[model samples]
Target: MFKNIKSTKTLVKKSLTIFLLAMTAVMFSSVAMSVQSLRGDSALDSKANKAGKHKIDTVEGGIERNFELQPPMIPHTIDKYRISLKGNGCMKCHSEKAYKKEKAPKVGDSHYVTRDGKTLKTISSRRYFCTQCHAPQTKDNPLVDNVYEGI
Candidate 1:
């Protein structure tokens, strides 16, 4: 009638310019296929891409606590132990006057508190760095699935 409303307004402006040029060619082809898959190749290394050297697991005894304030895995063999910044050889048998004459295993009471909870009598220069939260248990197994059901 007015030339069918100017051909239905040029068919809704050519269907909204072909749906905005097919959504700008699918948003620039998904950012050019995410910058061509992040320019391909890149996995560096560090035993994660495994190839050779990675055998250092001989620490006999301790490895149990995986919860309840978990931090007890030294077992033995700290290879030439020396927690640096001067000395510490694991406080020569877990300090507390050398854990009952080096029978070992003392140094608890939360290592004498202090990180604002303040209960120090000793061992708290921010817990005098004992491998920054104990670790050394190796013999590897469970690199992933842990389930962890503890309190």
Candidate 2:
């Protein structure tokens, strides 16, 4: 009975050792195969191997025919400007009352005109959003050569 118990213990220990060794071998083999596959043959390398000659050019904005040509782009940073139905940063300068004090050019009269050609005494609610027409002037190089001629 003693001999049988000892043999059983030995068998269990040997089985556990074999299971652990098999798992370790599987993990190492998978890692080695992935490393071999990734060596010097990635998709990024294939994309960078392309050969081409590219040309760059300067591009300008469209011609301005309107007298109030969008205020020559917002001269100052508008990050702090408030834009809401109740308040707008543009009104501080362009409004009838504020324009005189701020010395900023008032919004164009045409903006107050309705689609039916009726001009309102004040800025129309639909045209109150200043950024809708005015954009910040950025100093960045053009991405492509534009041959567009505006009317």
Candidate 3:
């Protein structure tokens, strides 16, 4: 009967679909088991390397940037300085009013400009954190080979 034939055809189609799905799952699971990262079996949560023990260099002037538009490096150590929401010790010397007396470089003029393009009398709140852009230099060797020449 056509009804019997239709029922058998439907059953066979469903069986073939289930078989194909099972095969695809097996292939994907095998590929997943064999694949690995460059870090090997190390866990995602664990650190890949230890922290460097070298001290930051206190360059007399400043470190020359290898690339243009690089943020100027801090010439001195910042161990004694404190930067917090309430106060920034760096502004004591680097502020517009004190840079001349302190003989320290003035904070960049761009720091006075707000995100809205309006220039403010004081340093913009967005640029208040000095260490966010600038960092002290270290005399330690590079982790990888350096072939870069100054631009």
TM-score of each: 0.23, 0.48, 0.63
40 Cα displacement, candidate 2 (Å): 24
Instruction: Kindly list the per-residue Cα lDDT of model 3 for residues 1-151, writing each as its tens digit.
Output: 9999999999999999999999999989977677654454567799655443668898876778878777788988888989998999889999999999999989888889999999998889998899999999778666445798888
Q: How far is candidate 3 from the true structure (C-alpha RMSD, Å)?
A: 9.9
Residue-level lDDT for 76 in candidate 3 = 86
Error of 2 at 74 (Å): 2.7
What residue pairs clash in candidate 3, if any at all? none
lDDT of 1 by residue, 2-21 (tens): 99999999999999999999
RMSD to the hidden true structure, all candidates: 16.0, 19.5, 9.9
The model with the greatest lDDT is 3
Model 2 Cα lDDT, one tens digit per residue, 1-82: 9999999999999999999999999989876555523123446546443333332222244234345343445555577788
Q: What C-alpha lDDT do the candidate models reach, one value each? A: 0.72, 0.67, 0.84
Candidate 1 lDDT: 0.72
lDDT of 1 at 74: 73
In model 2, residue pairs whose N, Cα or C atoms come closer than 3 Å (at least 3 residues apart or on different chains), thus clashing, are none
User: Which scores better on lDDT, 2 or 3?
Assistant: 3
Better of 1 and 2 by lDDT: 1
Q: After superposition, how far is residue 104 of candidate 3 from its true place, in Å?
A: 0.7
